[model samples]
Target: MKRYLPLAALLVSACATEPAQDLYAIETAPIPAAVETAPMVGKGDKADDPAVWVNLANPAASLVLGTNKDAGLYVYNLAGEELQFLDVGRVNNVDLRGDLAVASNDETNSVSWFTIDSTTNTVSHIGDTPTNKDEPYGICAGLVGNTYYAMPTYKDGVAQVWAVATDAISDGPELLAEIQVGQYGQLQLEGCVFDEANGQVFVGEEEHGVWKLDLNDWTAAPVSVDTIDARNGLVADVEGMDIWAGENGEGYLVVSSQAADRFVVYDLKAPHAPRGVFTVVESLDGAIDAVTHTDGLDVNSAPLPGFPNGIVVVQDDGNPESGVDQNFKLVDWTLIQAALGLE
Candidate 1:
């Protein structure tokens, strides 16, 4: 049976500790954007989040899965070519693992799913899961042992973490945990990613900050991963979050400092420890322009072509090259590491 628990009330019942009051705001840096894909198919604010699927057998031939939101998912090669498009109908905030890609669809008020054939690199729509949330927004995929989880958050802050048995065989998302979170500023929130390494999930609370909540402990209160304070370097509309975890619990929590037009990095071991913030600037080669007004982003430590170490992609809301619609920008993660002295 599925369970729905209100986090605000659970905090009182469970006797959870208060989130840390002290936050670190360090210096910021600039990480240059290498290349950006062509703008999204339509006009204002179309290109959204990105998910990188590495070809385990052929890392160099990896694919970048992005959401058009207005239409469906777009499969692009490393070079930013449109290999395929699935008109799944307004599936926003996409994510994938192995052969499956899942998203939050406010259009259908459900969670949509898609599959990709690794050999042929083609995509097929499987369908969407039943949703009870009023307006589905940010969505992410996670795993515990071998079981899959589909976590979709409502624009009003209701988050449903579903244990998905609906892969190649099933279609329903069995509710594992349904909880509430904070939604500030215009009843909005976007971008969520799971940290399978530490068994934690991070949710971006647009106006407030990022929150770190344990996956198994339903009663525990959500801790503040980081917050936006203009006195510090961070600005409002804190968007797009991703985790880059390597072996032995060594990694970083990256958040898009949208209002300030930069991305901030934090130590995963000590999540609140501010490492440095960075902006994806224009390429010196004039190949791409700076990244601004980023919404959702993705990062992976697995080595792939061009990016010998890893890669990260951010939604570039800017129209570089004088384009009309927004597109995603691919950056070398190592460059960001080196720029922020994370190496």
Candidate 2:
């Protein structure tokens, strides 16, 4: 499936606008000291992103799939126990479609498929797409009728969107559309989430900010909703994004400010603008670098009653000196709920 390429690649210049320095460091109520950490499959391996699968039949057995950038993909049980590993080599982003979990491997610039065994909390390799010249980063799964959409990060400044048969794992992914987003700073494409209800996709350029694209009409130019320069108290390097569906079935978009170790939650109701909800600090060691470079996030309604409806999980690009302990964090949504007070 990876046959076509754009005629030319162009990089978008960094926006000249700048916001004032962030004076407020995130301060919040103490997190649960008893919170358990997810077990690691190997020491020194950087775990970058995660996608969660809730097992309705066995609620307590839900699985959390994570990427080990230098290794592959690892599956863990709800209790944070590493259950299995699928070695695809340097996977950076992961998403799910039915029982299959798809991952983008940066090293090989390809996407690999894996089948999830919920009953046993395991992952088995299915197949992979043809390789590309651009390193693949963030991914989002969208379904249009029977076709599944696999969106890859920009290579040479163009993001390619592919359409694949949901059940045909071994067959290569067919290219459906290609969108060229000029490069911005060191930011390549890193985060993406589909607004299925609206048939739109949000792509994040690390340094430039986020762009909204319509799936139905690929020829229409993308609309830029927000940029790093507009966000206060955070760095320009934005990485991961997740949409939180509210009680009314509407939602908000939560994005990571990688360099500042914080998050900017945007209200999707009205003009679809950003409102700084709250900042998440590195609670483990209270070091700035500990939580810096936050990437990949997933939100799931808490199964337990009275707890906030959702929980936000983030990856910690740990300080280089803290060898053998790279990790991801599970942030309680209750505090964020209190801060936003959204009904």
Q: What RMSD does each model have against the real structure? A: 9.4, 8.4
Clashes of each: 0, 3
lDDT of 1: 0.77
lDDT of 1 by residue, 195-293 (tens): 887878888777787787787785677777676753344556777888887888689888887766678788887535878777788887877888877
Instruction: Indicate the residue-level lDDT of 136 in model 1.
Output: 83
RMSD of 1: 9.4
CA lDDT, candidate 2, residue 218: 75
The estimated TM-scores of all candidates read 0.87, 0.82
lDDT of 2 by residue, 71-164 (tens): 8888766555677778789888888766777788777778777877767766788777855546777787767777788887753546678887
- State residue 129's C-alpha deviation in candidate 1, in Å: 0.6
Output the lDDT of residue 260, model 1. Answer: 63
Best by lDDT: 1
